[model samples]
Target: MSATTPPNAPQGLQNSIISFPDPGILLVLINRPKQLNSLTVEASYELDSVFQWFDNEPSLRVAIVGGVGKAFCVGADLKQWMSNNKKGIPMDLPTNGFGGISFRHGKKPIIAAVNGAAYGGGCEMAINCDMIVASASASFCLPEVKRGVTPFGGALPRLMRIAGRQRATEMALTGRPVTAHEFKEWGACNVVVERGQDVVDRAVELAKLVAANSPDAVIITREGLKMGYESLGVGDSSRLFLEGWSKRIYEGRNMQEGLDAFTEKRAPLWMDSKL
Candidate 1:
C-alpha cells in the first residue's frame, strides 16, 4: 500500500507521505517517483516537521523510510536549485538535514528500507539511520562532487566514521556506486535482502522487533551507539550518556517490567518511554 497523509499530521507536506503501517511503526515514503524522489526545498522542510512529529508522538516507536519508485532519493532538486539560483533564491535544507534523516540526532530509531538506488542525500539518510535494511538491487553513491556541489548536509564525517576513510574517499572522489552487499561488508548496511524479497517487508519485521523491546532500552541503546560513532573519547561519551540516560532507564517502569517478565517467562508489557 502507498503512503497517505494523516488527518492531523504536520502541515506543508506537498511531497512525502506518512502512514502507520504497523502497530507502533510509522512509515514515511518519498513520493516523487517521476523525479526519482529528489527533494524540493519546501518538501525538505516539511519532512523535517514530519520526523519531529514522529519523535514527539508517544504511540510511534519506530519509523521506516522508503521510496515509491526506482530510486530511494537522489538528493536535491538540482533543476529547482538552478532555477532558484537564476532567481537568486537559496535552496536551504532544514536543520534536521536531508529528508530529516541525515544529520538527525533524534531520540528514536529509524530504519531505512532501501528498494533502489539510494544516491546522494538518500545514501546520507540510510547511513545515518539507526539501522538499514536494503534490497539486493539497491545501490549507494555520493555524486555531489561530480555535480559541482559538495554534500553539505553533514554526511561526510559520519560516512567516513562508519565505512572507513579509504572506502569513503573512493566513493566521494569517483562517485562510484556500491552495491547493497558491498555496503554490508563496509558496515554501512545492516541487512541485505536476497533477490525477490520485499525490502519494506523485511524492514517492517526488523522494526517490529525493535518496537517489541523496552522503548527505554531502544532509545538509551541508540544513544550509546550514536556516541560510539560521534564521540572522540569513551570517557566523555560514557560520562555524558550516563549522566542523562542511566538514571532514567534504571528508574523507568519498563525496566522493572522487563526483568520481571523475563524471570516469570512472560512477555513484557512495556510502557512508552518517558525519556
Candidate 2:
C-alpha cells in the first residue's frame, strides 16, 4: 500500500498488488479496495504464482501479506462462490484458496498486516501466516458456516492449535467477529497497532532486523526451535529440514561473519552473503 517499493519490487502486480524484491521481503497486497479488495478467481490464481515465486527465489527472505482499500480482504466473491460451487469446483484449489495461493507453505515467515476486517478466507490467510499484526480497526471472523460452508483450508486446525479448541470452535460455529484486542489477548495477533498508523512500517522494521542476521544461522535456528520439545512428541521433520541447511552453514561465509561481528561488538554485514 505504500508508494515506495522495497529493494527489488517492480511497479506492481496485477490488481494493483505489488511484489518488492530484495532485502528478502515480498509484499503481496490485495488491490481491490473498490470492492473492499475482494478476492476474485483470477486474483486467487495470481496469488498462487506469487507464493510459488517467493518459494523458488532464494533472494526472498520473508513476506508481508496484506490488502488494499478499507479492508485487507473481505473474502471470496460471493457471486463467484455461488457459481463455482454449483459446478462442483473445489474451493480448496491452490489459486482460489486464500490469496489464490493455497496448498503451498513457505519456510520463511509471513507477517499478516491486517488493515481491516478479515472475514472468512481473509481470516484464514492471516491465521496461516507466521505472525500477525493488526490495526486497531481490524476485526476477524469466519462466517462461512452461516452460508452452509466451512473454512476447510487450515483455519479450523490453526485456530485450534494457536488459540485453543474452544476459541476455534466458537469462532467457526458462531460466525462472530472478534476485535483486534481480543485477538491479541488470545495470542493470535502478535501486535495491535493504532488506526491510520502503518502496519507495513512496523512489519518492515521487523523484517530488516530479521534480514540483518546470518541467513544460515537463522535458518538452522528456526528449524531447531521449530522442532518443539521431546515431551511434545517432536519428530524428524525439523531434523530433516536442518539436514539440508547444515551443509549450507558449514560452507557459507555468513556464519563466520556473524561470529566475527559478535567478537568485534559490531553490527553484522551480510548483504552479499547467502541467506
Report the C-alpha lDDT of model 1 over 1-275, residue by residue, as the tens digit: 11343456665457887777777788889999999999888878878888898888767788999999888988878899899999999767888888888879998999999999988988898888889999999999999888888887777888898889999898888998999999999998999999988999999999889888988898899888778678648888888888977998899999999999999999998887777
Residue 267 CA error for candidate 2 (Å)? 2.2
lDDT of 2 by residue, 1-275 (tens): 12234344444467646656346677888888887877777777777677766655556666788888779887887777779889998555563366743333555667888899898878888887777889998999999889888886678877887788888888889999999999998889999989667987777777767766775666666656545521123557555655756777878887788888999999877643345
lDDT of 2: 0.73
**Which candidate should be chosen as best, given TM-score against the real structure?**
1
Task: State the weakest 10-residue window (summed lDDT) of model 1.
Answer: 1-10
Show how many residue pairs clash in every candidate, following the order shown. Answer: 0, 8
Off by over 4 Å in 2: 1-12, 19-22, 95-97, 100-102, 224-232, 235-244, 271-275
Which one is best on lDDT? 1
